[model samples]
Target chain A: MKAIEIDNLSKSYNKGKVQALSSVSFEVERGELFGLIGPDGAGKTTLFRLLTTLLSPDAGRATVDGYDIVKEYHAIRSRVGYMPGRFSLYPDLSVEENLQFFAALFGVNVEESYDLIAPIYKQIEPFRTRRAGKLSGGMKQKLALSCALIHRPSILFLDEPTTGVDAVSRSEFWDMLAGLKERGITILVSTPYMDEASRCDRIALCNEGRILGIDTPHDIVRGFDNRLYGISAKNMFTLLERARAMEGVVECYPFGQRHHLVADDSFSVEQFTRQLSDIEGLEIASAEPTIEDMFIKLMKR
Target chain B: MNSEIVISVRELTKRFGDFTAVDRISFDVHRGEIFGFLGANGAGKTTAMRMLCGLSYPTAGSGSVAGFDVMREGEKIKRHIGYMSQRFSLYNDLTVWENMRLFAGIYGLNRRETEERASALLKRLNFEAERDTLVGSLPLGWKQKLSFAIATIHRPEVVFLDEPTGGVDPVTRRQFWELIYEAASEGTTIFVTTHYMDEAEYCSRVSIMVDGEVRALDTPARLKQQFAAESMDEVFRTLARGAQRGE
Candidate 1:
């Protein structure tokens, strides 16, 4: 049986006026690191809540660890670990106390799962006596992850774990997740950062109550339908405006050091090169689409 | 790059009790420059920004923003700078038009000026239809764009945007950058912070803070070359990985 399975799941709020999730469906294999990639309010959290059995779906059904989500919620709760996007840990409690309290609630001793959470917990163990609220953003993140894993859950669900985290800490957090996956634990993580999609074994690109696509990061990039070009000039702002105004240009958006420009078959590189030759420090090269590029295209469709 | 300096700091420091949040950081931002201030969490980026914005006073050192002293002329500094953060800066309960009026009034604009600016802003954003709608009801992307627009409504000499595009989609993120460029083009210096490395590359110059100090500051190309890295992300990781103080 799959670690998680959902069929036609839908949810709404404010008396059906707000649709948070719309007929979302997917599955996660045991021990696989799955990613739910999307921006804020993309229904990532809504789906997690439904699968974790915190809330009932408005339609359809789901199961986790071979148990019905609604009918066997108690079984799933004890079996799966959930780390909410917010800092839900007790702010007043010390790091050690918080971990102990969570472990006790799940009827397990800290020693029982020390091996499972030691790698993360040990980094924060020096500050075990510190209040959870007093910890820094990165330290707090580490503490939260330790607590979520203290119960030795078979599956882990992390919601936007790196939303406001810095680049360095964000990279470290992914490395921790990768470590957990290697220990035969199935992890379902969500993040708003597109670059993180590459870290997951498979990802579901979600947006505004819908899933845009589901595939490996590499395959998704390969699925891009257009020939993209990266163009950069002294004045990027003016370049964006001019590129978009040029004939045959389908799309143009800033990507890091250069602007990713997509043009139709009618686009003549030789002719455009002559037209743009006068611009100072101009460089244009064939570019490969990233997951972010594919995501924008999917949203447009 | 030759524009007049709008923000200048030397040996700027902020300390609380035994902890030093910002320690002797110094830099200069030119007029109309999009200066990217970046760092790991708890690396003093916020503390330094607060000092510059006149929200918090520094414990030591000297600085000036928009030609006003950071320590003695905080009120003047506040008047000449605009600020917008992803977490706060908007009135969710108020309609789009009402929020505009509120901010404009606070910025000391006259009724006639508020009306004119509000209509022009709405039209430029093609958001005239949503003028009466409450800001809370709009999508996150729309709300973020509106917040930036309102932050610059007074045409301040410098605008500080704190992670203004944190969780927006790719397309909307680009749109936000377009707005930043537009504001800079009009001579509104942009002092922005973001975790997005790509956004870092967009800036004319960037400063990466580590352990309560400005460790690296240069143009994106120069920084990349100096660090021998292909992208800003690598440079950031190289500098931030050694940070001992992280929250």
Candidate 2:
């Protein structure tokens, strides 16, 4: 059976003034690692809430682990773990106390769930006596993940779990998730960072309350139809403007310290170089499209 | 390039009893440069920034911002600098124009000057249509950009951005960096803290703090070469591997 199945899901807020999600459809196979990639206000959080049974959808249907989201919310809730984008742990309680509290809510003891959380819990175990509020950003996230996994759910829903942590912590967090996936837990995560999308088995690129594209990260980049080139100069701002004004330039935007330019059929590297020869310190080369490039193109479309 | 040193520190230290949140860190930030401060969540980055921004007193060591001693001239440093964070400090209940006027007033701008600057800023950001709209209704990216503009409204010599691009989209992030570059070009020093490694690459220099100490500091390219890594992400991992805070 599929881990998750959604057909034409729709939701809105403020008496329909804001359409948070509009007829979205997607499915996740059992034991698959899926990602919901998008920017803020793209309805990623709404979708997570709906799937986790915290909020009801306005239209359509979804099933988590063969349990209907609305009618069988109790079953769905028992079978899935959720970590909200914002930190929700009690500040006054110690790290250990928070974990014990969450486990108790699920009618389970920390000892019974210790094996599932061992890899993560061990890291924060040294600070078990410290107040949850006193823990650092990375430590807090690790603690939160431990709480989520205490019940050993069949699937996990993590909403932007690495949004504010440092690069090392982010890498470590993903590693933990990958380890959990190895034990056969289906995972669905959402993030605004495009680079994180590549870490998932498959991802749905979302924007403006809609799913623009859904595929593996490799397949998504492979789908870009235009030839891309990386161009740089002494003055990036000037280079961006000039590249945008050039003929046969389909799209151009700043990427890091360089400008990523997409070209039309008539474009050639030599011709482009000759066109901008007057500008000093110019360098251009062919480049591969990243998830960010594809997202920009999809948004424009 | 003979750039002026806007900020300098020597063995900066902050201690809360025995915790030692910031441990003798040292660095320098030059005028018209984007200096990135990176660290693990509890690695003492916030503590260090607090000392430099004059929000908290250091237990030991010394530092100066905008040529003013951090120990005795915090108020002066505050006046010469602007700050923006992930959670912007704008009044959401107020209109865009009202927010601008309020901030300008706080910075001691006269009424006529406030109106002129607010109008010009709105036009420059293509936000004229939304001047009367409530800040709460604007998109996240738009609101962040507006917060940045307001932070620099006084035209301070330096600005501190605390994860300013958090949760923003890639396209909007690039746009935000354009604003950063524009400000730097006009001689505003940019001191930023971020978790995004790619963003670190855009900085003129970056310092990685691990366990309340600066583990590495250099330009992105030089750091990458020194660490023998392909990207900033790997370089960060190599430096932060020995951290004691997070297992």
Candidate 3:
């Protein structure tokens, strides 16, 4: 059975001045890890909110575990775990208390759900007496996840769960989510980080409330038809300017220290480098394209 | 990497009632380098930055930012350092130039100096044309770039960016980092926090915080090698588990 199914889902805010979601429709296979990838104002959060039934959609419909999103809102809330982008685990309660409260809210006890959160709980267990407000961003995130999972929901909706987290904490957080996937819970996570998209089983590229593309990370990159050349110079700004100025350079944008340049029909990497080397105080090198590169290309297209 | 340390922190701790937001952490931020300070949302990084910036007093610790003691000379530290918080800290009613001017006035920059600095920053950030655009009217990415510009209005020795690239697009983030690099090249120290591991790669060095403590601090390359991870994301995960194991 499909874990999630949404058809022509559309939502807006500010009296329709802001269209939060426009015909966002997709399906999450049972036990699959799905990512909603986009930048700010890209409707990622809105979509997540709608899926969780925090906000009613202006048009269309969605279902979690085949339960109607609007009519079965209460049922959906119980069957699905949602950790919002912000840290909302009760601030006054201790780590354990917050988890217990959430478990109770779902008509379960911490003992009944403790196994689900054991790996993460152990880290913050020592600080179980510590107030949620006092916990670190990473800890709060973990706590939120634990609360979401207390009910052993059929599906999980994590809205940018790894955002605003340390690199190490983010790494651990994804691992935890990956572990959760083993139990066959469909996970729908949205993140602003393009790199995180690859870790998902599949991803929907969103921009300005529109679904730009949806496919597995590898498939999306494979679909990119452009020839990519990565180039770097002593000065990034000058290199960018030169690439933009270069003949037949389709897209010249900085990826890191180096810049990735997509070529037109006539543009060649060797020839492009040869011309770029003539520029003073520049270091040019070839590079591989990442998911960020793919998104840049898609956005441009 | 320098003889003169821009910031020297020792045994930094912050407590709200019984909670330890920052638990006796310490680190040194050198001059003229991009330093990445990373943590989760409530990891106390913001609290620590606030303490270092003199906006919040550390419950206990001894630190000097830009040669001014955080405890004794907090006002002086504020004057010598700039901070861009995670939230859009600028006034929405103000124009880009107006925000810059307001910050300049607070930082004690002269009118001519403020104009020269604001114009230069705006030009570098490619928002010179949008200088008159109301900050509220601008997009999320533009506002982020503008906030960074205003934070450093006084040309402080060290600038703190609390997740400066939180929700902006990749293209704008790249542009913002260019500004940071330029500032670093010109002898300014950048202390930034970000969730994007790719952004962490650009820093000369990065430190990961877990539960109000520095879990790992080193160059991104070194951390990656030590963790035996292909990317920063894995490095973070491996270290988080290690921290969990250690505890």
Candidate 4:
């Protein structure tokens, strides 16, 4: 079953000065962990806003759980859970109070929905008395997740769920989402982190208010048709400039401490290393291309 | 405990009207090191950072930044450090190179240094061809990259980046941090705030902020060990729960 569907979706703000989304379309299957990968102003949030019925599209339409996004807005709201990127919860309320309030607002009692959030809520249960604003980033994220899941909506929309937390919190949050998915919840998450693309079941690499490409993470990386090499040296900057200028080199951008150089022509590691070594203080080694590489190459075309 | 520390705060506090935005917090940033400041929303990360950056004054206690007393030398600190906000702060009307030149003038860089550094920075960002391209015409990631380059063009002693990689793609983020590393190598201390956990792993040391307090400060690996987490994300969740330490 298609959990969510968007068709001919277009939206704009400021009397057309801002084209937030444009003729976008896609479908997410049941129980799929679909990711909308893009940077700021790529219409990811705009799409989320439209899907959640927070805003109406100037053109196009969408559906959540077989209900029209516009006509059945209230029904859709109750049937789907959403966690916006920002911490929008009331800071004055305690952790438990926030959870209870959200539960009541959704017309669900904590006792009935407790099982769904057992894992995450358990960790934060002790901090139940702490004010929502006083809790840590990771804790607030968990609290928000639990609140979103309290009603057990079949579809979930998480807009940049891991944006501002520590690395550990980010990982744990994904884990909780995975667990939620296993319980038959279809997940649609948007993130700016390309490395996070692989964790999704399928991804749509988006930019400039358009969807560039949509495919499985493995397929995206496999689509990178070039020999990638990592090079470093005493004079990394000078070596980078020279490598970028090398013959048959397509792209030479710094990756971590090493320069991830993509060859325009297929070249052996030895030849690549030798070509780099000719530049004083240059060092090189074979390397693999990441999702970011695939996204940039696809964007170029 | 070293007197050479670039930043030292003793029981610093901040309030807005009736709300205590930053609770009493204390931490010292070294003279030359990449210090990662992280927190969830409303965790007092922004308030704490504002106090350190001289954008907001503390309500209580005192501190020092870069040898100048933070309480009385806020102006001196601003001249010696570059700040890049999470949102783009550059002039959209100006070209990429023009923005750099404008910021260069703000730092009092001579015409020669401004021109030379603008060219160098644009080249490093792979936007040399777009030197004349209006900042508004560029993508968010590109704008963010250029902002960082321009911020550091003045070659300040420190750079304060508040959520620099918030909405940027991973590839852009990787390049952004490289520039930061280059600046650090040149002996410029980096006091960066971010929500991206992986970025925390790259910092020489990280401090997790919550409720206006420094909850955790250490190497990523050490925090991982302390939290029994295999990755930075797990470490963050574990600590974020304020889970009692087994030891």
Q: Per-prediction TM-score of chain B?
A: 0.97, 0.97, 0.91, 0.90
Ranking by DockQ: 1, 2, 3, 4
Instruction: For residue A234, give model 1's deviation from the true position in Å.
Output: 0.7
**Candidate 2 colliding pairs:** none
1 versus 4: better TM-score goes to: 1
Q: Per-residue lDDT tens digits of candidate 2, residues A184-276?
A: 999999988888888899999999899999999999999899999989887766788788888889988877656899999988888888989
Report the C-alpha displacement of residue B152, candidate 2, in angstroms: 1.0
Per-residue lDDT for A1-301 in model 4, tens only? Answer: 4899899899999999889999999999999999999888789999999999999999998999988888999889999899999988999999999999999999889999898999989998998999999887778888998888899899999999987554545666788888988898999999987768878999999987899888899887888888888787765556777776767788877664466888866556666567666666666677888788888887777
Worst 10 residues of 4 chain A by lDDT: A163-172
For every candidate, what is the interface RMSD in angstroms?
Answer: 0.8, 2.1, 3.6, 5.5
Flag the better candidate by DockQ, 2 or 3.
2
* Estimated TM-score for each candidate: 0.98, 0.96, 0.83, 0.76
TM-score winner: 1
What DockQ was computed for model 3?
Answer: 0.43
Q: For residues B4-62, could you state the per-residue lDDT of candidate 3 as single tens digits?
A: 68988999999999988888888898888789887655567778888889888889989
Question: How well is each residue in B23-132 modelled by candidate 4, as lDDT tens digits?
Answer: 77888887668888876556687778877877777889889877777777788888888899988899999888778878899889999988888888877788889999
**Rank list by TM-score:** 1, 2, 3, 4
Q: Please, what are the lDDT tens digits per residue for candidate 3 over residues A138-213? A: 6777788888889989899998887765555565678888998997788999888887787899999888888888
Reference A-B contact fraction recovered by candidate 4 = 0.41
Candidate 1 clash pair list = A136-B247, A137-B247, A138-B247
- Candidate 4 wrong stretches, greater than 4 Å: A266-268, A278-281, B1-75, B87-138, B153-155, B174-247
The lDDT of model 3 is: 0.82
**lDDT of all predictions, in order shown?**
0.92, 0.90, 0.82, 0.81
Q: Give the runs in model 2 whose Cα sits over 4 Å from its true position.
A: none
